[model samples]
Target: MLARQLEQFSCIRQARVQLAPQSWQSGAVIVLEPARPEAMPDAAALDRMLDTLALIPDAPDKRHVLVFDTEGRRLYPDHETDETARREQEVALERQALRVLRPLLDGNGRAEVLVSLDEAEKGRTTGRRTISVLLEENAVPETVRPHLESLLGQACALEEGRGDALRICFLPARRNAAALRGLALTFAVLALAGMAAFF
Candidate 1:
């Protein structure tokens, strides 16, 4: 069944279908990764793929499905009122934002960011052309900070958007795994001391 479904899209060189035992929302999960990084599925091909996913069994739950790209972008079940799509879009945006921001981090830096689209009105057309990156406390270097914003702008310009949108962000930079080990050791020592005092 999967092989037949895959043959329809030449752009989709490979496909995988997994019937997960538990889902936050119950349905089949279809993952598609392109043969090339730059390959994108057109609207009609995407629609057909969604239709193919619809045929999968939803015996124990409602017939809802999710399709994700290699970069973690959600591609299916994008209904008008689906609240889940908003969360998925945020995830996709974050992945894209990180692609631009990670290079600025000079190895020691780590960050968690929230990427959002704020609508701006210029004239008759409505736009969410501005990409806003909210850097939740991070270890970004002071020297790299100056040039990071311009690089983001250039990165967005090279990609596609709803309109002539551009990217701009202030990404800041971690918790080392070694720090967690130290925390565990401290807890153990405290527990032993308390037990000794109690006895």
Candidate 2:
């Protein structure tokens, strides 16, 4: 819906919108590829685009929009260099976590995880490292949890945020292996019961 609205403008060739990091609650980032590289949207056009983004339910109440050209240039919040850097750093952390978690999840791209770095520990060992992994029913398989946590802890220990505690959380996303196995067992039992009754 938002993309269609943005496409109505002449300057926008295509508009791709994504929540900051990975989920909807996070702020929005709109990457715009212009119809003509030399003819970027004017300030008024940008304002209109931002307004449309702000109207989305997931958008924050403060309504700050970050626009980036295909070249990784910041188009708005021009003064918020620190904020931009912070978001980039968060994204970097997220990518690192995914590097380790993806294989464990069978390369499921739909898996959601957020890795947040504490700014105070930017270059120091005293900063906190938080890894939030979205799992089904707040459960992590006994076999997977310890190994996954160990891997993440090792990653944090090696990074700048190693001095403080390493926090790991399991948020709700898709069902994990244990849950799927239980579901399969239930189906098997029901099927056996039906066959017994028929025989």
Candidate 3:
């Protein structure tokens, strides 16, 4: 819907709109494939358009720095270095979210347990945190989700938001043990390193 609206504008030859969900409500990305019309909106005009869209939702935003293009040209909240900084911020947010989940995990299973984060929550962790757990075993233990959920249930009360603390979905492993171990190690290195010495 928004993509079509953007194309109708004289400046945009083609507007590809991908609405960014989870982090900021109104967050979106617009890619302009320079129109042949020879009168497309300039970098400055496009920046303003992005800002207007960012505020379109009724909710207050978390001061998003939206990218107008991949050239590291335009950004929101006016001043910033480049897109690399934004990438680093994303890494930081992921780290924080993982930290929030670390305590509930047993971190001792031989199974290649894959802790997953929703792509939307990858940008920001807010409200009730949701995570997926995939056990790289022929049969995932019945205790996995229940144990984790039980831990989370004790971590906070419903009034304190434990009811939505974390949602763990599971899938049985299909790979050979060795491959699963290697994948689990790689994921652990990226997601759980420094999460705890116990891990």
Best prediction by TM-score: 2
Candidate 1 runs further than 4 Å off: 1-31, 34-99, 108-128, 134-136, 157-174
RMSD of 3: 17.2
In model 3, how large is the Cα lDDT of residue 153?
Answer: 43
* lDDT by residue (tens digit), candidate 1, 134-181: 543454667766776677666544335545444344443346789989
Question: Residue-wise lDDT of candidate 2 within 103-175, one digit each (tens)?
Answer: 6663343455565555554465333556666654334455787687678766545454254444555555566
How large is the C-alpha RMSD of every model relative to the true structure? Answer: 9.8, 6.8, 17.2
Question: Once model 1 is optimally superposed onto the true structure by TM-score, how far is the C-alpha of residue 173 displaced, in angstroms?
Answer: 6.8
Q: Better model by lDDT, 2 or 3?
A: 2
Local lDDT at 97 for model 3: 41
lDDT of 3 by residue, 62-163 (tens): 244354433324434346643324433433343444444554344443322221222324444433434333433433345655465554444332124322
Q: What TM-score does model 2 achieve against the real structure?
A: 0.53
* CA-RMSD of model 2: 6.8
Clashing pairs in 2: none
